[model samples]
Target: MMMNKEQEKLPLPLLFRQEANESLLAFCRESARDLPWRRSVTPYRVWISEIMLQQTRAEVVRRYYDRFLAELPTPRALAEASDDRLAKLWEGLGYYRRASLMKRAACVIVEKHGGELPRDYASLRALPGFGDYTAAAVASFAYGLRAAAVDGNLLRVLARLFRVEENVLSSKTAKTLREIAYRMLPDAKDGTSGGERYLYDGYAAAEWNQAMMELGAQICLPNTQPKCEKCPLSAYCIACAEGCAERLPIRESTLKRKEEARTVLRVTDGERYLLHRRAEKGLLAGLFEFPNKEGTLSEDEAKKAVEEMGFSVKSLRALAPARHVFTHLTWHLSGYEVTVPPIDRAALPEDFFAPTKEELYRDYSIPGAFGAYKP
Candidate 1:
């Protein structure tokens, strides 16, 4: 591959690269946490864990991972799971679309791949919700393939190590960083001599990838808060020597979150509460939620809103205000509890249902965004 002037200046010295690799691997061997996914490494387990880890904290994914696996242990099982059951299993995860796409991919796997995750990166990338990073992760971690899983963590680590000044989020910088990661793999060619140069291979490749990620997550952190003193790669990090590790990996664009107001209603008839299923597309799709509308409503307006849905309001009381933030949206919520007489089930909207308190908690997948308002 041809190198631009910037790329030419980015390559580390060969001896330093070798020492850095050994230091990183040793650090991982000694200090790596016993994460569940690392314990029992399977293609299916890796796939599930990677998906759950996206835009979610590893600590948070821990709560859902084991439960999700216990219920749907195999691709075939996940392929056959009902929508409601799947949604319930993924209730607190927030991104419902990932669950939906996983089901679609599972169905394809069961039909086309004999109920096993495909071992090749290309085939895995073709599956729903699988991207370059995910495909590479599964290939390297699960199948011992020589693929580099270049996630944000790895990107930051690389940028700091080489003192890259470009925006790490750009495609060009990402591609260059990925190439550097690939070259650092065990038994990878150094791109110079004709002779085959072998450093390490097989499971060692997986260990190297995980070690890089662990370093970034725990020591070489982002947001001007890197713990360079504890980082294994600090000795060789160009950014560390320059006293700018925190500012090395620049991001060009910062997304502005759109704010919105919502009025949530906890309409109940002493025993059962009203729930509505969101449309099958868009944000929070297909999940059960407390009946809510787009904007804060006055107490009288809240009562009128309930009546418009064909309900008789016996009493109305305001509940505490709540807020939930998504990736690019913020919901400022106001809530109300409305007591009503028992209504005719047959007259309710097809998309609406009234479930007893016990049933609501046990069966429905009410998102945590409305947790503050749930009775």
Candidate 2:
């Protein structure tokens, strides 16, 4: 790959100024996907969609966006929703914390912002789950403000466009890219109408920001080699010119995920499975799960463990083992089917509730980590 010493030292924004902006917006106007969130533009819609899009892809988010809005149409609805309903709607999205935070943020908006999202960046950032990327997204896309929202996609595009050698995952590198995005915004801001609908003339700040993100998602993909020949900004892309577009956005090596062995207890009578509501603070908070204990156990050990929990185990059979991966950890799960006498709700531990198969299907919300063992 060829190297340009001077280009490596130049700021990303200055390297691809107006020429890159026009190419990106023009490409987007012709090639942007017809996403659900883009069709109905609103501060609330953008807020929910952006939060959902974090660490998740657009295609996956498509399945949930409209349904979530259909159920919780307003901030008040979301704030007042039952935990089961919210979790059920957001089931399979993988990150339960995002759903939890969205509920909290809705309450804040209802109580403090008068049931509407604040139009300013500072106020939006103050809301739960609205980080720099999400806040700037709401400000620029929903409000037509000249704010730059730099996300992973946009970061890759900028990093490759200017051949940045800095680690893109670092906070300092993120701030630098955000500055570049701010500089790349369209020169004029038309401002929002302070309502739920918006229409841009293809060169507005919102369009520009979306265009950059779209280009990154469609052309400058992260996992594979970028389609530079089809990219509108290829002419000005330093990485393309240097034949190293695939290697520009450098990231520090990630730590290995810690492995855990777990034995999932599926204690059942004829009516319902023994379930418990997790603590309201840590991982999988407020979600339902079958009774489980750490470490894989033998059939005799499993029966003994359940008896220790104050239940008489009748029979035990080992089921298949499954694995679930989180961002920092992986759970190697061994499941067991244990038969027991009918549970007495009064005798069960606090916060433990057994739901019948029908009720579990229709009402409860279990985390994806327990999917393999879920009946």
Candidate 3:
């Protein structure tokens, strides 16, 4: 908790979190961002929304959030679900590890905490996928405990408001931000619960956290491109006066993806396409996909593989080539949507799969953002 001479010299009133909270709340009540998760607040619901929002847009999150809730229903249901099922649920949502770790977290609640999400900050932080932002979000939003949820949105807001220039990727940024937030807390103020002080002021905490995040996501925005005209806190924001809001939340750099060539096999038997469920662990794990090999395969080899699978390749035609980038790898993809004469029904391998045209829409979750789906 030691602050350097420079940090200690900063005026204490400048660190007031409640003032920032009030500014944001005033903005939100007058112009709250409409989101589904905002409707009902629960530990589990808020936790899922937090995970889905990581590196994903609010619109895209809205789609996944509803589907995920409908399918899993509860923590116990998610905990017991197979990795394949979980991965399938999270299909097309990159960063599959988030889904995996979330399932692991649910399992821990069942085994260690008797199916209840522990309310303590430390306990939530120890969960498999919980980072500081996520941990703080769960604490504030769900439990009503005052904490800072410093995601990208919050970081941008803080950086612009404070005019901080530190690289946000650095751990130093996280530490400084958290320290600032700590100074801002309302000193454990007493509040009513059913006309009595049951204390642990959660309602105020929830409003405070949500308002900060909402302001950041909608108004403060990345750099100076912020919609200053529509912003409610324009009068108070430091970046607004300086006109350097966009330049505030500086980041280090994004890792370069290694380019890899892949040939996706689009083997088909006239009406249905061949597919398989990939193995668990490593890239697109458990999502259904056509057989593929790194780099282009010789037509002879591709023909041989198809024949071995008990299908006669009638013709091979090239579809539009596509590309999909992941954190570590870039798939420079080429697909050959081949037509195969119907193979013997019983001869198909156990893991081998075929999807009717309608089934493509039903069964598998292809990453369409990456490339066009072909059968």
Residues 202-262 of candidate 1: C-alpha lDDT, one tens digit per residue: 4656767788888988898888899999988888888999998877798886678999999
What lDDT score is found at residue 310 in candidate 2? 85
Badly placed stretches (over 4 Å) of model 2 are 1-17, 189-199, 253-256, 344-347
Provide TM-scores for the models: 0.90, 0.90, 0.85
lDDT of 3 by residue, 1-375 (tens): 223467655555363445554555566676766788877778899999999989888888888888899888788988998876776678766777788899999999889988888988889999899998888888887887767677778777777767778887788886877666545544345222223221123466666567667777777777457987777667667777898886778888557779998877788878887877777666766667787767876677677667776777898876677888777778887767768987454667876778786887666665543336455
Give the Cα lDDT of each candidate.
0.84, 0.82, 0.73
List the RMSD of every prediction in angstroms.
Answer: 4.3, 5.4, 4.2
For candidate 2, give the lDDT.
0.82
| Candidate 2 Cα deviation (angstroms), residue 243 | 1.5
lDDT, residue 296, candidate 2: 86
Task: Show model 1 residue runs off by greater than 4 Å.
Answer: 1-17, 188-201
Clashes of each: 3, 0, 5
Error of 3 at 58 (Å): 2.2
lDDT of 3 at 230: 77
Which one is best on lDDT? 1
